[model samples]
Target: MALTFTEEQEELRTTLRRFLADKAPSAAVRRAMDSDEGHDPLLWRQMADQLGLHGLALPEEYGGFGGGPVELGIVLEETGRVLLPSPYFATVALAGQALAASNDEAVKARWLPAIADGSTTATLALAEASGSWRLEDIETSVGNGTVSGTKMFVVDGHTADLILVVARTDTGTGLFAVDGDAPGVTRTRLETLDPTRRLARVDLDGAPARRVGPDGDASPYLRTVLDLVAVALAAEQVGGAQACLDAAVAYAKVRVQFGRPIGSFQAIKHKCADLLVQIEGARSAAYHATAVAAEGSSELPVSAALAAACCADAFTHAAKENIQIHGGIGYTWEHDAHLYLKRAKSSEQLFGGPATHRARLADLVGI
Candidate 1:
């Protein structure tokens, strides 16, 4: 089957690209990454208020545009194109999905509007001190509507208005939403290699929380949320990969070597060709996963896993090769090649990494 973009999708993509080009050019991205907040709040507001992006995937009742996973995938892909330094992915892609999957209407009513309007930023506090993303490995305890434990590498943890924490209860793993400034909640930002994406180590010392769903049957819901995240992230990976490929190709045509353009060299030509092939393949995988997510079919899980793993590898490989094609300039901090590389690495590890997804895909197929 072939993947085709709807008119709305094409329009959305064009608007976002123009917005980024005007508001967040490469210099602005570099400045944001170099800033303490690691992002620009003004640009975020433009994306939320001006574009209504925060609400794109939310229901209409929640002040959203009533779009679904496919819309979100489109937004993520555009965000990847410019490497927009914001927490939209962590907030919308993961936390929004977590809330949507919750069984509690009260929680949804309270949080979804804020999220949809960009009045609130939320993140999933799932990865523990052991840094394991599995439900079984979540050792944080939830008791008496209170939670206690340390959640590491929480995306936007420090900046979130709310935190959806996955903690272990007596019954099993459960989802809880704790206030960002709730008492007993402490945070420490890690000095990470990727400055564009912020992560924090969150410590919950019996922090008061509102339980969103039951504890025992969280595995299935968790899988669904993860699949949705993967679908959107795969689109982002493909976008990043395509950006890298274009950069490499453009540089090869312009950069001179041996008294001739690098594009004339057989080695650089082969490298660009390989990168283009990988990007096309990754685009196919990402489109398939997005379709499966939108359809909510039984094949969603396997397709999402396959797409996530393949996109991660493809994007990472293409990004590294792009830098290599740029030679010494790509390695410098002054160049934009490293930015794509950092994003590729961070995104690859976001949803349990390639190995994790491949293993999950294998198990999902009962192989």
Candidate 2:
């Protein structure tokens, strides 16, 4: 298969990169993170209404642009580079995918258009306080058109207009869509290392809910969404790693040490070289996974697992080394290196860690 992007994809990437550069600059990101909603409402609208990024991966019939995973990857990669602090991942990635996977026309009509237009924010209350993304670890329950349980570290849970909760039913595991402001739903914001992406602990006590799919059917679909999530995160990680590498390299070239540029030193040169190599490998995995996700093949899971594992290692390594390369300044909060480090660690654990993905890969390929 051709590894390079097509002309249309390249144009798409250029558009997103420019948009993010202008709208999601570092200052903008910091401002959004500090805001009560933890994101910029205006920028969100621009992305949806102007760029149509919110609907890139959504179906055309549902008021989306009729694109797929690759287009989403383009936006995600750009967002990662700038560390854009928004609910895009929670809303566009998780909630959007769940809604797309559902067969409920009423549900799609109710939420997809709003999501596509950026008028509504959405998230998934799937994981528990134990912070497990595994199917077996889910303990939420739904009965008589209501839900009850605790979901913790839910991405943008506090501000979501719609929430897709994974609940255990009498038949099997299922997905339930709940109104974010519905009665019996209480959200508590949690202070986190990655404040740019807000996390919340949600308590749902007989909250109004609607089933999205048949019992047990959610497992495969959830797995597919998780794979997509992994792909999106991998794209983000690769972007972050690339940014760190660039920052470190630029700093080393100008920073004086022993009457010369530190980049001229063998130690620093070797470190930067190693980081570039790792980033190159990670980018390959990330891009390949995105393509595979768009194609919707049987090997999608395998591709996603590989990409996630590679990205986790790459982003973590690059973030740490970036700090080292920045010397004492990197340790300070004033420097942007620490922010990348925090994001790297947070993304690494969001879905499954590297070990978890590796295990899943073994199972998927029967290795």
Give the alpha-carbon lDDT of every model: 0.86, 0.88
For candidate 1, give the lDDT of residue 54.
94
For model 2, the stretches where C-alpha displacement exceeds 4 angstroms are 215-217
Can you tell me which runs of candidate 1 are displaced by over 4 Å? 214-216
Query: Cα miss at 230, model 2 (Å)?
Result: 1.1
Estimate TM-scores for all models.
0.97, 0.97
Deviation in Å, model 1, residue 313 alpha carbon: 0.4
For model 2, residues 1-367, the per-residue Cα lDDT tens digits are: 4567889889988988888888887888888989987889888888888889888889999899888878788778888888898889889988997788777788889889989988889998777878889888888888898999965568889889988998888877888988889999999999998867789999999999988855554788777878888898899888899899999999999999889999999999999999999999999998999888888888899999999999999999999999999999999977889989999999999987999999989998999
lDDT of 1 by residue, 1-367 (tens): 3268899989999998889889888999989978888889898888889999999998888788888888888888888888888989888999998887676678888988998888889998888777677777877888888999965569889888899888777777778889989999999888776778888999999899988765575778877887887888899888889889889999988999789999999999899888788788888888888877777788888989899999999989988998999999999988999989998998888768999999998998998
Against the correct fold, how does model 2 do in TM-score? Answer: 0.97
How well does candidate 2 score on lDDT at residue 200? Answer: 90
